[model samples]
Target chain A: MRKFTILAGLLLAVSLAQAQEYAPPKGDAHNGAALFQKFGCYSCHGSWGQGTGRDGPRLNPPPAFPVVLQQLRTPRREMPPYVASIIPDQGVADIYAYLSSLPKAPDPKSIKELQ
Target chain B: MSKRIKRRQFLAGVAAAGPAISLISTTGTAAAQTAPASSIPPVPNDERSLNDMPPQTQGKSGSDFMIDVIKTLDIDYCASLPGSTFRGLQESMINYGGNRKPEFITTLHEDSAAAMCHGYAKVAHKPMACMVHGTVGLQHASMAIYNAFADRVPMIVLTGNIGNSVTRQMNVEWNHSAQDQAITVRDFTKWDDQPQSLQAFADSMVRAYDLATTVPMAPVLITADGDLQEDTIPPGMEKKLYIPKLKMRGHPTGDPALVQDAAKMLVAAENPVIYVNRYARTDNGPALLVELAELLQAPVVDSHGRMNIANRHPLNHSPRREPTFANADVILALEPVDIWGLTNYVADLIGRPDLPPRRNPNLKIIHIGSEMLLTKSNFQDSQRYAQVDLSIAGDAESTMPSLIEAVKSQITAAHKSRFAARGQKLHEMSAKFLDAARQDVAYQWEARPISTGRMVMELWDQIRNEDWMMPTESQFISDWPFRLWDMNKPWHTMGGSGAQGIGYNTPAALGAALANKQHGRVTVAMVGDGDFNMAPGVLWTATHHQIPILYLVHNNRAYHQEVMMIVRMADRRMRSNSPNLYVGTKIEGPNIDYAKIAQGYGMYAEGPISDPKDLAAAIRRGVERVKRGEPALIDIVSEGR
Candidate 1:
């Protein structure tokens, strides 16, 4: 799922307007995967990054690394803000790499349940 | 008598008396020191009385008379878990009362029993009685009682306790008995009584039903003593027992002067809105509210406490609550539980429970409900105070007739034209929201790991045509059904758990299904996996009673809501390396097989169906089974949120 996912299209239109001018630094996917669970990002976003429709949007095929970093640094809505002192720049880059590396949601038409 | 002169005879007599006195003192000390004030056993006047003729047993048990009183109240069902304290009454209900009017429903847990009553009341519009084992049962049932109280649903809670210490068994009975069992639910119950005699039980039972069903309805407790239940009616005492005339008082009306004033304000306002929660008590509730809203052409925002109005109605503004409140000049709040929340901007951020008023500076708020008529100092379910320009202390449904008339009288030819113009704009806004919602579902129209929206829409496709009632928690299903489905009936969606308890959805939904069974309404419930695990046994009761329902499990496989909160905490703490958040929160290591669990409870079951394509068929089969008058379940694995 992308930034223009289903529920986010409905609920978080306001939060999606954050500027994404700055790009994040490159980081390792393995460390990112480990940090994703470590930081408890899986709580609102699924363990595999399928965002809770009402709570958080799907992060798979995450937004530009800069947008992800920006959202963490300064959340627009109910999401708690994460400052650099907390989730340092390195941590944010790794988490973004992990999210970006995840597989896209399978096509519903191809899956038996969605048919 | 002359043998007392001998030393041997004197010694024998002294030895026997010594132990007897010692035994008496030991019993006295234990009773005085350890027993509760009411449970203290009286010291024996003479040991000979213990061996005397068995105490005269009553020819007619007092429980028989108690059953007669219960019969008078016309309760249709009585849910209970077995306990020895109420054994006599339980027996009388079966053998004497024939258990037909208020049939005994054996439940596994007291909470489930209470929840069932809660759900049953929402649909039946009358309370179903429930009996639980004394103090422990009430403790188990406290959460459900709180939920019922918060929802303002009427329920009659009959608890059993040993009234006579002399009749109590040594250990278990002592543990089970309370001097005043009503204290257990004193904070939440509208009223309660520990009836000492059959007559008192009769009077209290009638009073409890009256109070529970009155405006600002709530659960009421009546603790029946074991001795009173077991003891035979004192000879001719049956003639003395009087069954009080069970009368449910007409709902009180709003004051005429205040009604006129509120009507005038509403009529004059440029932009007015009606916010309602728990406004409906019967089939009449939604219609009455709609009539008033239509007359004024005002937007009505249902909080989904009860189905106050059809969501698809042009006047319904639920989807646009924030904007509606923002623009309102006059806001009429009816029976809303969270008046403060409706009127203010309460943020979800840390330590800020309240923010500045959400409405306009000069917004005129007129609140009407029996909220002011019933309240308790303990257990603050009532939200923070919200200032109101006018407050009417009466039942919203009852007061609506008079208020509607007043509004009708105030509307002139000029006002009629204004109302039409306003209605058209509101209708357009509603249409826009509906269109947006329709498009929103199309985004993941066929997404794998079925979207909650897709899943609910799929279920809706099957049941939309049936006379359906969905008794579910709002959070579990999200906003999909409300946004998409035609909730045109009062029972279309019976609303959320009153106290926001987790275990409520499964059992309460089942209870609603039981009520729907008689009416031939197809019942469906969307329950969370975490909630189902709380009281899976409800499925057994459904199966045993042949109460058909299609139970759909939103198997996110976690306490997803809590999971969200925990993650936020981890982010704030900068514990970027903490993997233990999942340890306590997620239900993953050995993911539960919900389908198998439902089968174990003897319901037709299928699932752990992850593929969205599989949902429609599974749901169809489940619906078929329910239509065949059997319970069924479908577990659909999906996104965590």
Candidate 2:
């Protein structure tokens, strides 16, 4: 969900980055959803809060609201650049809310899940 | 009368009775969920609905449903060495992606995985995705990616990352990922992304594909985090995901003012020389470049990999960088890779095309390309190389056509050389070289083990006339058959020696062909079989796509170049006999049955062709299968035995 949010963020980046100050869309996941598809984000990222662990960055793993948003608003190199309206502030807030609703971080025992 | 017999045979075949198309495996995953709690594999009887995947509401995170998308995109298989970075996602890819879904091509070396992806892509036309193990995996695959990038192949890489240790608490997240991983491939990639959210992950997929497949195509990579790849989204988001239609930025044209100025300089020069690289990589680059040469009766050097113009054109000269410099009064470097090398050589010879490629006190040099000009000086203390006189870095493809129009507007048609004399000179010179080369023992450029020459000749004898997606190992092709194979059209053949990476033949070539298959051509890769075995897994990708291509395995049992080097070193060191000499470099014992391996992957296969006499016929047979719309392999076994 968060990966989709970031990807959706790229297609609409010009608008999202420029409209950082705009009002939130009514009842939208705002930051609860992060457009993940636009960046080829989830191709490597996980379907849920978990990142695929190689190329995809960690989405808000839990306490999801705004966590994924926080990471996207700031990123490392070689990312096709993104900003707020390209992803909207309200959309970010809604997606953040949506993500916060997902499962919490995996327990340390998750690696045990691999074998 | 024969028709009646054939019909009877056909009827008999039909009466033999075949089963209905069946699901290959309906429950690699679901059997664990439903199926009455049994260990048995799910039967094809149910005919699983791909639409039924992602059972819950897959609202924003489209990850769970991407398997269907991969199917829609026609990705038959992916050749990747598995890693924990993509563990969860890989689970979904296998368990859920379905029968025709891109299957995981297990591999040993990460580079082989990438190269396999490269090979598959050339023919698959769509990206046959390669997955890497975080930073280390990326680093290993970098060479193959570079080759894919340089060759302009469309590849999409899915890298599983363990997000920064401090950033996420996901289990084992610290063991993977590079801080700024995509930076490693920046020089050649079209686009890259590392989404921090599920929704964005899915959306960028469309964007990455669009960019990778755009004109002037190249691979694009996206880093997905292990944490992000498995996250579940809200309900039904799979249906909501949309791949945005992308509009490519077209090639830019020069201002009439700029074109006129450049053209004036070109026509007026006494000893003008043209330098071309990637332009010749494009179908138009060669034509436009040749037109300019014909108009000026000037010499052209092939920094451009393939010989666009006749090499023996009185104006056509060797592209070895130095002499190309001495003879030119004006220089135009089109799509140059080493701008520094070109400029330093032509500093006093040529000037700008958009501006001029020449440097120094006299010659005018123009640098025209879609990307910006980077002189070697960019690396060395930031000093501009003799500095380009005129530089236009947008759409050389379009710019040249217009310049042609402008030059035509001014220069008399009679000014164009009939080029008859020059053509003869080239033919004569080429024959002379081939004659001398056949005898030359210095470097043994003609030594056996499928002398790059023999390989090309065999390839030409086989597939020159049929439409082919030619993904050549950069060096081998340029040395020979470059004169031998005539590529007069865009996408006629795709190759990138620019980066000089091996293992690319398998994946990138296949990927590009996959993208262009509807364009209708047998995608052919003339690669050393050693390289073939390097990423043999890609064959499955090709098989799955049914992309017709002939993979000619130049099976020289040894890495011939290494043996040559070892011999050189031994002779130099005068170590009369080193048992270790050329020991590890060979693939001996019983030579590999590459034909069997190819057949195992579902392809028509032939060879271990030791005799050169068998080369043509075997090649013909292989070419026939490719024409029939199936991948085929010819293991042209050659070595100095």
lDDT top scorer: 1
| Candidate 2 per-residue lDDT over residues B462-548, each given as its tens digit | 676677657665353334444435555556554453455555666556665555567677777777655676678767767866877
Error of 2 at B189 (Å): 4.7
Worst 10 residues of 1 chain B by lDDT: B2-11
Model 1 docking grade? acceptable
Model 1 residue B260 CA deviation in Å:
0.6
lDDT tens digits, residue span B175-204, model 1: 999888888889998998887788788778
Q: Model 2 chain B, poorest ten-residue lDDT window?
A: B374-383
Clash number by candidate, in order: 10, 202
Score every model by TM-score: 0.86, 0.61
The list of candidate 1 runs beyond 4 A from truth reads A1-54, A57-68, A85-115, B1-58, B445-448
Provide the lDDT at B509 for model 1. 93
